[model samples]
Target chain A: MRFGNKDLARYPFLREALSYVTKNEFKIEDLDNSEFYHLVEKAKRKIEDYVFEGKLAYQIDYNKTHEIIVQEEVIIFLISLLLIKSISIDSVTKKFALFESMRFERYLISDLDNSNQDDKTVKLILYKIFEDLFQTKVDLEVDIFNFYKIKISDYLDHPIAFQEREWNLVNRTVDKGYVYLDGSEIVRLFRNELYLLIIDRIKKMNPEVLPDMIISISDSLKSRWEKMYPPLRAPGHQDILPPCIQHIYNQIDKGENLSHPARVLLGTFLIYTNKSMEEMIDLFKRLPDYNEQITRYQLEHLAGKRGNTKQYFVPSCEKIKLNNLCFETVVCKGISNPTQLIYRKSSK
Target chain B: MTSPTTSSHTSSSSDKLKDSITDSFNYPHSVEDDPNKIWLEKVFRKHYFNSSSEIELDNYVSEHEFGFRLFDGYIRRHLNFKNKRELIASIIKFSPSDIFCSPARYQHPSASMDQKGWIGADLIFDIDGKDLQLDCARIHNMTFCKNCKLIEKEVHTSCSKCNSSMVQIVELPCQNCIRNLKKEVTKLVEVLHDDFGIENNSINIFFSGNNGFHIHVVDESFFNLSSMKRSSLTQYLLGRGYLVDNLGFRIDKSDNITMLPNKIYYNKGWRARLLSRLHLQLKNHRIDDKFMRKITQIKETNKIGISGVINNQIQNISVKIDPNVTIDIHRIFRLAGTINSKSGLVKSRVNNLTTFDPFKESCIREDALVKLDAFVDTKLFFNGTSYKIKTGINNIPEFVAVYIISKGIGDIYIEKLK
Candidate 1:
């Protein structure tokens, strides 16, 4: 690990502590001070208490709290991305890991913003804070810990209720209020390549397995999202999609029913852009055959284009509108799902 | 320890020193003679701890268990962050064994470096009065570090005076390390550029303000890349390799092929490339007045697909909204960052929310939701050690709404269902 100017000046105590540990693993008795020894002792005691409490109840090996702590640490660690600048898309997934932890921090801190600002304002703040941090425009005042509280709540109370497979995520978050992931765990959580592979595998599976396969796939995707952005309560009155889906939503037309596939598409887009709307739109347009006729039609449709009832060869062309402006809509009928359609939109 | 009764109430009190900084008696006090914990805890409690009411006692106890890890990049050379080495040399006089530790998050992948970045150190520090007790409890239950990371090894150098261990390291390179590790940094930058079709001008580097360097490529082209492509860039830079298999458009010998089993496709590669082009076009294409013409043209092209080719260009099914559809102008503007929320609806909401009602602001609904309600309702998750938005009985939404609402594109209202 490297030391920055700030870390060098403010944390000499940390450096000294690190020096002793990596060298010879010392015992509590090795150090001369009792206060420092007591601190460690206390932590071990509480952990033991949790373990004992669980054991007495015939629960799992370690208290779920231990894993929650580990998870919380990872979340804070992810926030360190703020210390670094020039954040790129590759770093975006890792960035979400920080946001995930911040959600947990909020729960720990207790007090969060209680403004009447639109739900989007809250959503925007979450997104903006990350943007500010990545761009080095951080508000030293913006506490990442409190931020996680609202986020975790949002996940738990996600507007779309949890299903059977989401039980693990629900248990981890609802029961412990934290989700654990190490460096590898974080990587695995955000590794979109794996999801793509799973989708590919499902494509090869026989039709009989398709339903279960899709359910399993949705479960895995949801689980990953819960780990990445676990919530404590479902989405509240704010009609805006969760940060996970806002940018990915083709359009936020009123009464648009959100399907799992649509959410996944939105999630994938959000993950790719670090949840930046501008970045997401950019990624959407860059798919291999994204500019082909079929792709254009879909993109136009998402942009709010409506179909031209009079068109013969094209049957009915779609029309989309931005602001008050009305534009022709391009449609892709073959792909029933938004996620696959997004893929089709890009695959020429 | 001296008993509180024996000491001059003001003699060695840290609270007295802090009092001079703030006249208000808002500082948090503990049972200890040493007021450092009290003061730090006071500041932390005010800024971070008070952000939520829903937090369970167990949760609060846990946050205190683990003192947040600090990676502010403010350490001096001739120190290590591994255990208590850095602490003893610079700040605290303690051993690493005294504190419980965990791995840091968002660590730069070694792919960003030529060599494995130096092994770092971790420590517990008191910010806003956090101490061994609260920090220890936090460590016991909380998994996340509000502010913590592994110290880069190369960032710090050995002390000339004592030859003591120094360990704040740089991931990309320190000025000193750069002289030694320029080749690696350059290699990474080149790889990032080549793979993403990004240009050299798009690449920029910055010091992490600590022991590492951050590399950014700002090309819009890269933005058009999908998650898989972006992941590949990360993997490539981190040397993680590529996705051997995934459902996407693969360019085979300059031809496009869609491997999505049940879908029909004409020119797959071309479509993928077009998608990239449109993505760039949208990113650069603003919604300002000047860009409106092009926007209209796009809409037209999208309408009655100009050719069988254009018809095939659009990929996803088109979703249409009612031409009369109107969203809350305030909400939309808030998201867009164009409208100043101060003068409009928020002002009245603020007034109504706060109990100080001398202004008699009428815009605030007695039942209107205020910022504090919003925080408690939605943004409670990120409220850590700082940035607290409190909601008490006095300030209601109707009070503040009088100060802020203005006619915008439209006002988007999210009702709080009691």
Candidate 2:
């Protein structure tokens, strides 16, 4: 399954697209030059749209032949990555990754849904991605539920945040090491991989490499980002956290090893108090054994950010006692749940 | 023969070893021991010296964390040996009550658990006879309540007098229960082989030196399975957590579940297993034509439907392995060829399940005559040989004496003779 120049523009994250860009010798100097002025504007617009709307901003126009910029898309994506890296803010980088992967997810699904058995290229690309790229074995007979059989190892490594019993490996019909999933679900899995791939290129860059066009675009992005996005940690509510939760929070703050149940208590407590994804990631990164991969999987699962989409509630005082996690204080006497502790403390 | 003085003082002495590196203590002297434990130690010492070849240590032996439980109930852990001879030497030196080794390979085998860089571990499923809940256990097992001090067959959940469930069950599981445990192991092997695609040769089963068995999947593919994946494997074998919705069943708009009976494929996964179970139920005439008609005809009623039959099938599910043992990757399993403290029998490897008798084959010590004070009326039945030994002084085989003494059902008769 070979990709054409138009397909390359659509999936610049693919190895073939990167090779095409490298083979054409797309240079960094072209971003600041008149010869690639078409791409420079598009790259800046990509970063600007990412910081503000968290959306990808490019589309192909096959009908309008004069406006076709198929050859410049990969170069624009690379320059956009350079601009993001020059910005060097972690939150902005994460936002860029999330948007790009989501956009890819949207595009990939539309492409697959539009294609049929006669479209030999889609079937070939399915094998090319599963067999060649991810090395995942696949049998693509879309069943009654639009599900296809995939290998268990590949299924286990799926990057999508799913906590539903339906998503559980045991709950699915696993036959001879194969799990079932739909095309959209499969795209969701690789979309996360594409996210991490983009993130790797976005971390820790020399703002020294910023061109005039990139610098102007980044300045606008930074100002807009500072105005729009809230700080990862919201002020207040820390003191009002239940004693049991506070104990765990303090333990993590000091880079101590809290037990699994204790971490769950603290995680659910923070998530329950309207702490966003970035805030939770910020809070958990302070732990001694914090592995970003593991923490993200668990935190997203608890937040119900993915499958089943059922958010976890903080354990009540009675339930907390069953796990032996309760540290009752005189101020917490009447409160039955941890979420109530905020009002309990503020009332005093 | 051990001196009468040493045998008498076995349970009296305190631990005298101060050093941690050596981890050795005088067997008949300062380290307090049980008489049954001392006898078992003597048997193990001879067995390791003679039958060390049979005790196969897991590969990369230097990277395995070995541990030993002493007669005084002290566990010496985080020990490593370079070769098989060194392990045997330690076994012969310590005369430990039981032997154990980690299934995991570590960078620093002697380091603390967190410090031990765990590379991988074999997937093991432990099937203890007590967990099987076989009816035969009531005939041979005994339960002693902590509060009321009542001793009887293991048929009570709560003490009649104290009403407290603070009871300890002493299980000398008979041949019947052991046979049931073997059947469970067979089921587990089949499930691992067929459903999970684990080869039969890659799966090794060991009698747990007691009334149980341990299955180890030694294949390289499974060595690096995470705790989550291992947990799923356990669930699959036990027939729990299956999604009937994925297999052509759905809750109807009117509330009752609607299932496509025509779509039930009798060739793959849970559908195949469930249909086979239904076939058995049909053969027994328990599931009549009316019930079959009711199942295929159910659409939109408030009445409870096919869920009852499915729930019944799930209840009488497949494998009966202890889930905790499989899920925990860091667990130290009993090393094969080591004597189990529960019954003074070796954890021997089994070849033929039909003829393998734990009481007979796992008995490594010479069958010498020994007198014992039997504590209860217990039956020792295997291979058409049955002994319904009653309370008070009785003569029995040395192997039988060690078992009965270790199980807390009998005592060595030397003290009574004196």
Candidate 3:
């Protein structure tokens, strides 16, 4: 958890760091400058302030919102790292120059604002702040938040990255053309097909064994899926869906030879996509020791179309009419790959 | 089809997985006696009762390597036991109720060499002998007498070392490992009770016999769950706030399998479980569709397929995991908007020709980065079942815009200039 500017002000150095990030103008060159002096003084004062206050922010009013924002500080830390990556000596000097212009104290602090804050006095103060307030950069680098992070490479292969990037380029915006499908259309197109598929799989079964059989099939699908896309090739990048897939992938990876039925269940959902409940049932039926009736009940119940209260069931057919679906073009036509499908179509 | 018994016998034969003989044999006396005596008795009893004669088997003690070969002893013992039928019967009557006959070790061709191979110790007792070692000794033949005890390859040479012997064994860990594991288990139990909803009736926690604890949600509600629901539950268990990850588990060898109430993301730690749950809710229903519409997205990018003529914005879009797979609809539309706008020009210019002007761009791409709003839509499903089929569109949240703006997409400037 972390606190924002409102909370950081209770500690002087953190407050200074926050202020410097927001207000200071850094030059690409020259460490000794007036603004640099102020930066040093401010940072030093914050540190001294923290030392005296003894890190006492506990008594201060803390609400749920503040707590959440504080917890998300790692995200801010990443941004800071990115900023630091681009900072050169010249940029440091420029920032110091901006600081000196603000009539800051000189030389009691070590000037991290860079050599541009070469006013010997400002450098002293800045140095003091770095020494006292912040932990060593080396230590920070190894911190769990920074070092133990899962690199994108651990989850994605080159081909998947290339493909995802290409798709990203292909679908650039919401204006060119795409479509959305309504509930009724989806019902007409997928309802019956899904229903029949589910029924067919469970039509003939030793009633007692049917449920377990269906569950097992689900697990097989999931396990097969994880095998297909291991965590090293996690499907999506920082994407919502991708992370979800990654979670499932990790589970299968850990418990590959699991004997439990639950393990099988996990494997099924992770990999089984683009198929309706009925289709999944049909897929399950092809395996050994499967019952048909239980699958019928489960699939029907799963899609919320089993009991007949004008249920918007899955459509039974494959061919989709152009008029029944909705689309909105996100990218301009003729700009990139013409054959790529980059639109999201929603059906009930 | 053959009867089940025949099939079972075939199953056993196919795998060649023997029901090891160590289970049946018992030492003549307590294991504390001369360790050598205990070892001999255990091996002798297995072969004598294997329905094989004991007279053909032989037994002897040797100082050169401190070992015994079961195969030679098997034939002598088998013949001897068969000849002394009355004595064998009397011994059996006196034996403990648990004792039974076991298979004899078969002799192999090169039993004279001390080379490490399957010595097949029919029964194994205590292994605490001074310089004691048990191995799969290669059996050569029943003809070798006690003085000419079969010697395999000498112990630990460049050519061979004693390989694994098929025998019953027990193992215990070091003190340090036990202490550390106990502490971890205690901490984990507390975490489970506090967070996982694993109270008395619905759940049970168990040791995975290695590292980590397993919480079994025995709630009948979860029994016989389909793949989808189970996945959802798994996600919820591992998600953040559940702290499924922090349930410390020691990674070392142990017998008690620790049951993890929920799956951990990394070695141990929680990611955002609630977010995943929210995502599920969204995916199940189209409720987040409105939120998705609020965030500006590109138009359909499906140029190859037939598409609807409506000019509506993107919502409830699905992205495929396969990167090579073409964008279905929303991705395409988002691309089109980007390609045709000023943001596109900025993006292209940054990557290609002259330095791009961020000032003029006004962070247009940033607008697209806003976290897309999302919600689960119950109205979309015809049936009212709500266990979890979370489906919905996610709008880029507002906070994400700054970062997205900083990171420009490809070909943005070119489209803008055009």
Candidate 4:
């Protein structure tokens, strides 16, 4: 059941790379000696050509990195390194290795700036494919939670629960609306050490051949690989709203009578964004039987403009659910409140 | 209470008080002459100056405001030093009644006025014994009404004599008060370690000489937390101004029944705490006799009814912390190993909090003897020994004398036995 020659049949690229590296005795005396580096460079060149050639039949103008192909190469490279015993995994190292791999998978699908719906869909599909192809055999998902001694149900249902554990394991920044899972610093350094050794030998052999952009790109990719999960904002800015907020917005647009919490959430969200009073009044007019005076008073009250002068915070995720208005989508996972979503959206 | 003293004794006592005040106003000549000064010098040299030979002052004490409370009761504030040796030398020279360092980090800790650019500070929690709600029998505690100039024998929020709200509460630390303080300390440690995920080594716990405990979290990650973030954390611990309605619990309007969601059990923070407590009450017979009987009669079948019972007890479970201390980053804390002017004992660190008896452990002046002129009949306990005093000069251990004098019940004079 182990991942070895048997699994290599399904993954031919891994088999070929393993044979080539093993035949060379896996001695990385120079960059040219490393077939893995050549494969990465080739993959990078292919992505760059695909982006520059205008071959993609998409309307998005940004340069599209063929992340799935890059991910497949990365997986194969890592598997070959594992096979050759280049990247050793002890009990402690195994936990971080799994965490890093999961992070990589998560990062690949993470919507980069300017990514459209089609790009996201492709990245998700590729991430799933990569997960099925390698992550399962490695048992990364189970091992990550097991390392923390937390049940998967507890971790998913309450992501903040991880914050109660060790800081080296998980970092929860509720205000930032994200939880960062830390990979082992030792494993990360080891990977970078090996990568730098290859790059160093490459420069020593041919100093003028390496393009400046290529070197910079390689350095950026290396740093990205080292950081398990850096802070990131949601893509598409405010245009991409959480499903619940979008649902409420649509309801208000159609003059539907929203529930009390929904109205409060909408009003608070608008006020938080510094919407004008007139604009808020106009928006509230969408509600059925919405009297201008009552709406103005309520808005003014929530904004702390009324007599009591108490500014109200937006309803949390649980509040939305308690008010029977929660209609969550997959992206809403690990977010606790509507304000967090707005914060993330605005951070973009 | 004895009969009021004669006018002759009162006038003589007043004249003596004036002479003693005038004499105390003169600063000590040298460390050799004063026992308190000698003790401070020896402790500072042994613990701080000698032991910290290799450590640079910039590492721990840099950019921190140094304050000294001299024996004359005048506080020299906003003082700074260039090096640890200089700071230690100044502390030994002054032999201050109390030493304090600002909790806040600053660019120039010594700079006065507009020059001291403020930075961030360590997240600190101060659990004072005076603030704890201890239901113990009152002793020789006293309070003064500022508005009516009436003194009371017991601590009160308002003056009973004049019905004025401007009454000051003077707290005398007792066994019950210290025990209550320990409970708060334990709760704070749990919240910090279990709830906030701060490591044991990262947290530093200290006994504030007279009446409280101070917790300092030196973890670098929290160094940059804004005041707003700290306020949030304080509110979270105090369980005040929290939105408990957002916990996804709903009530059925028709039957007036409450339902607990299955997901709430897995939710973290206060919601998870609520669920677990409820589950414990149901599993064990820890509920009230009436509720236990009702649950037993129902055979644990009605979760809605049980949840309703648990919901009423939510506020009682949350830990109480001093919100102001946590929120104010610029607040100063008593320097460790320095004598508290009130208690005349060093504010020392507790290595193991569970077995720490503050009264015995903080008793530093055990060898010295002191004569205290008691003004009221009071019973005092120290180090498992009890002393009953009746309005006269009583010779006792220096520690007990300091305890009595700190409570404002008596005046103490150190007497060297030849």
Whose lDDT is greatest here? 2
- Per-candidate fnat, comma-separated: 0.00, 0.43, 0.00, 0.00
Model 3 earns a TM-score of: 0.17
The local distance difference test score of model 2 is: 0.68
Best candidate (score: TM-score):
2
lDDT of 3 by residue, A1-348 (tens): 232343332222243444434453433222233433433333333222222222212222344464333322322322212222222122222222222211122211112233342344332333233333322111111222111121111111112212222111111111101111122221221222222222222232222222232243334433543443333433322232322234434443432222223223322332233345554554433222234676556555444456642333222112111212112233323322111221211221
Query: For model 4, how does the per-residue alpha-carbon lDDT over A271-344 read when each residue is reduced to its tens digit?
Result: 87788999777566545435678889999999999967989887788888866678898778789976676677
Best by DockQ: 2
Residue-wise lDDT of candidate 4 within B79-180, one digit each (tens)? Answer: 776667777877656666566777677898766535677787777887776565565525446676889866567677788988999976556677777777
For model 1, the DockQ equals 0.01
Q: If you assessed candidate 4 against the hidden native complex, which CAPRI class would it receive? A: incorrect
Q: Could you give candidate 3's per-residue lDDT for residues B141-162 as a string of tens digits? A: 0111123222222232222223
Report residue A70 deviation for candidate 4 (angstroms): 16
Superposed by TM-score, candidate 1 places the C-alpha of residue A96 at a distance from the truth, in angstroms, of 16
Off by over 4 Å in 3: A1-348, B1-200, B208-214, B225-271, B274-418
Tell me the TM-score that candidate 1 gets on chain A alone. Answer: 0.18
- List model 1 lDDT by residue over B304-360, tens digit each: 422232224332211111111111000000100011122211111111111322123
Comparing 1 and 2 by DockQ, which wins? 2
- In the order shown, the chain A TM-scores of the predictions are 0.18, 0.67, 0.16, 0.32
Ten-residue region with minimum lDDT total, candidate 3 chain A: A171-180
Worst 10 residues of 4 chain B by lDDT: B1-10
lDDT of 2 by residue, B281-359 (tens): 2223133455445555542231455565666766565688778778778767788777777777888888888888887
